[model samples]
Target chain A: MSGGYPKGRIRREDLISAAAVVYGEAGYHGGSLREIAKRAGISHAGLLYHFPTKEALLAAVLERRDAEDADREQLGVPPGLEVLRRFLTLAEHNARHPGIVDLYSRLAAEAVTPGHPAHEYFERHYRDARHRVRDSLRVLADTGELRPGVDPDEAALAFIALMDGLQVQWLTTPSEVDLAGALRGFLQTLLTVPLQP
Target chain B: MSGGYPKGRIRREDLISAAAVVYGEAGYHGGSLREIAKRAGISHAGLLYHFPTKEALLAAVLERRDAEDADREQLGVPPGLEVLRRFLTLAEHNARHPGIVDLYSRLAAEAVTPGHPAHEYFERHYRDARHRVRDSLRVLADTGELRPGVDPDEAALAFIALMDGLQVQWLTTPSEVDLAGALRGFLQTLLTVPLQP
Candidate 1:
């Protein structure tokens, strides 16, 4: 993105990054396009040249975040025990990127209204994320990793819930809550059959 | 609060409720005092007469919600595994209150920024909530109800995390997520040495 004279694409990336900060702080409805333009070091019309509408800009921002996350996280990591291990790593990653976390947390909460802009995006994200989690648990359960009577689907949802809940605590009080350690302790209790000494 | 006109307190309650709805929909930064006043069917001056500033109104709304939550949830139902069981019931209650959940979820996310108005409030809330959860786990650990090697503090934080995380998911997609059932499964794994049948 740096070496070439692809000024148009660079301008687009700059706008998206600034928009992420604005939307992260002020929320989608609260954030203004003009503010995003100002933050990105461009005029309002310059921003409009790149992104014709707010909705378009928002979609681009989300798409870029997804791409960045996939590249950073290797989203295709194998399931089962790796999912458990990656849960810790993902929390660690989120801890470093407060801007993305704040943007996501704000949008997800607001999007519960069904007609909100990010509603469909979040609906799909959660459904897919939960499916992967359920598959991972089912894989472990098949190998007798889970204790008797622990439903794979239930464990998957609860594990996801624990991850989300710890994230909220971490975002609010970083020093007091250790997201990975807390999650590890939870996994220890859940997988008591001793995969570890 | 209605008939004879100790209407001052009633007016305050009405304003707070209206503000909650506004904040829940538009978020804290997006919502305006004028809108809250309009929603409450009172003049802007009259609203401010009750609450001198927007921050004052926000504080009042949060305080009232706290009072309502305490009154509704039997926060003193004895500790131990009973605390674990009560977690399920609390989630059930939250399932019915999407307004509070939406308002809380949005505020909690925004408050992650250190300077946000609800920042200190949420920091204190998690600290206190985690401490209570830890104390409850300690009570159970003393009775040998907890599985060996389950750290009381860590388990407490994880349990709290699970509850908060579950609430967010439930609020977003109520039909797919079973808040209570998922919680019960997590607790079963945590207390798996079977102090019960």
Candidate 2:
């Protein structure tokens, strides 16, 4: 990324960031590549040189977000309770990044239909997300940290659901919702032990 | 509505239904008025005569859906845990109606951004929705049905989030999620008594 084309790398990042903003505001279908180029301070051909198509740009954007998450959470590093703890941290992280939240909320909603470009991406994303949470829950269950009679599978679904659902409300009316606090309160209901700092 | 032109009412219904499908599939920013007109089997001019603008059509579509929900749920009538029960029933109902779920999921997510056509509408919608759920929880608290130490305000936020979050998962991979069953299990965790049929 640095040796042959350092300027190219910077330009690509600029385009992706600008694309995220446009797509976040107007959604994938409604967002225009021309507008993205304008926002990125590049020509249309220059933008296309980096991302051959709009779908390709979207894929890059989505991949970058996941990579940032994986790195930030150190996912699968310590495993178990730490993963769940990271998710709470993730909620706190998301509260400050409204642009990222808007992008995800819009794309996930649109991708529900069968033929959307990102449909399969989101399906896999949620499946992986659930698996990660459920694995941590299993760890808690084995350690006697999880409450008795709590099904890991069901709890995972509800946990993931709560996180996703809270974003919508928070974005709609940020003044009314304490996103991180609500998430922490929810976790207290499922576990017997305190979340370690 | 019926006296002057019975045909007008039926045609309007058809347009609204078609608009829902188009908007659900592509979202408000991406969905086209022409496409809606085509799907409803009417001329573009005829569609414009009824709708005037895309934003106006969207308002009608949203208003109609709310009216149907209000009618079906008998909302504000026989309030309390019954309202919660009705929400469980509503999940069952939503399971049967994918299109309705699609419309709501897509619109709500898209409306998160400021300046979107349906932005304020969703702002008010979530506010009213949370209020209804909180009122029901208050009733449960008074009757000693709510779990001790469970804050009704926090519980309401989580409840709404669960419902909203479940829709995205269900829509992404329908075969994997049992929307109504998951909702029931979450309610079990919150309430002391079994939900009465």
For residue B29, what is the lDDT in candidate 2?
88
lDDT of 2 at B125: 91
* Model 1 TM-score, 2 decimals: 0.92
lDDT of 2 by residue, A148-188 (tens): 98998998889888999999999999998999999888887
Query: Lowest summed-lDDT stretch of 10 residues in model 1 chain B?
Result: B188-197
lDDT by residue for model 2 (B110-172), tens? 988778889999999999888888888899899999989988888888888899999989999
Q: Candidate 2 overall Cα lDDT vs. reference?
A: 0.89
Candidate 1 per-residue lDDT over residues A55-81, each given as its tens digit: 899899888888877787777887777
- Interface RMSD of candidate number 2: 0.9
Model 2's C-alpha root-mean-square deviation from the true structure amounts to 2.2
Per-model C-alpha lDDT, please? 0.81, 0.89
